[model samples]
Target: MRMLRQLLYRLIISLRTFRKKGLRAGFAELGRTISRIFYQRAEFIVIARALLEQIPPAASKQGLVIRRATTREEIASLSPIADMIDMARFHKMFDHGSFAFIAFQNDQPVGYCWVSEEVDRNVTRVQPPLHPGDACVHDLFVSPAHRGRRIGRALVSHRLRFLREHGYKRALAVVRRDNVPALKVDKKTGYTNIGEMSHTRILFWDSFRYNIPDA
Candidate 1:
């Protein structure tokens, strides 16, 4: 009787352990499957407008106001605070770079875009150096609720004109293949593709290489 009881206890414990392991494994696989499905396609349209004469509202039809960001505070207003590293680093870049354009509606910042320039330099080695005369589009974002009304396009168009006036021969922006909206925007904007899609293995606190795909 004693022997039977001991065996029964061990069997119960073994069964519980097996069940727990199976649950964990299933969840892990489910997470991977979900990620795979999400990344399988592009997301977001990156439209380019000629120039915004007015600020577009989140709901009611209102004009969008677009202009160059002259101060860190101005840039901060446009930033979504999605990542502190991006915010801090861009502030630093603003000091070093030339133009940082921002868009607003009713005096409230709606979107922002910037271009980094190296006029005479042959190339910039960022992890893997970018070619000389290539002006990189640093930041481009429209508020989640305020997108689809050409706000992003206007900001980008304004920046492009600024870059052209400043003598930038070409512009470059790295987009994740999964960003469908951005891809569409680029296509409509007359910005051609140039490849340099190598991942930087280095990680930093609050550093985001690209925006996560919106579901």
Candidate 2:
């Protein structure tokens, strides 16, 4: 009976290890063979959370560090997708008048936020012209797993303060109405909902789309 029990246990373990016999198993074997390789499939999410936390304490009272992103490479280095268009746009638009902030923990990039001096065409056409010091929160993307920890709020607040210090009177953060998390950050960070626009406005985004060659 003891022999039978031991055999059953081995069978169960073998099934767990090899029953599927697929690509995942092959990768697992590779991982085992290369014991020193560190694989983190969820690395993007971990970094996103870290980015949100690096906002200064004066912005939302969170204890996170904030620093200016010094170069286009620095900005691209922390991007999740690292697209050339995004990098070029950053280089073209970002300045002391407009700033970029990165969040880090233990020297690893976790999140990124930037303000732009450029104004949206629709917003400018419909509303009073934004003051020269006024800036817009262009993009805030954190990894999905690292959300709900107030990192967004901290980043925005820090940005607002930075803009104010640079003599900007107001800060603008355009959020999609359906984007619940972004809208939540808007409310929590004291960004007033001043207006709305149709999604048709996204037509301008065509210029930024990637042109993939036919397969």
Instruction: Report lDDT (CA) for all predictions.
Output: 0.54, 0.51
Residue 82 in candidate 2, Cα distance off native in Å? 4.9
Tell me each candidate's TM-score. 0.58, 0.55
- Residue 68 displacement (Å), model 2: 1.2
TM-score of 2: 0.55
Q: Write the per-residue lDDT of candidate 2 for residues 105-215, one digit (tens) a residue.
A: 446565668766775442222112244555556577654655666667777677766666666666655454457777666666655555443322121231211111210
Q: Which candidate number would show the highest TM-score if scored against the true structure? A: 1
Over 1-215, each residue of candidate 1 has an lDDT whose tens digit, in order, gives 32234334444444554577786665664554444332433222222222223323223236787778787777677555334435645666766764577777778777777666642121222321235555667457777777888877777666776766666656666566576676666666675543334333221212223332310
| Candidate 1 lDDT | 0.54
Candidate 1 ranges beyond 4 A from true positions: 1-62, 79-83, 118-132, 202-215
Q: Count steric clashes of candidate 1.
A: 21
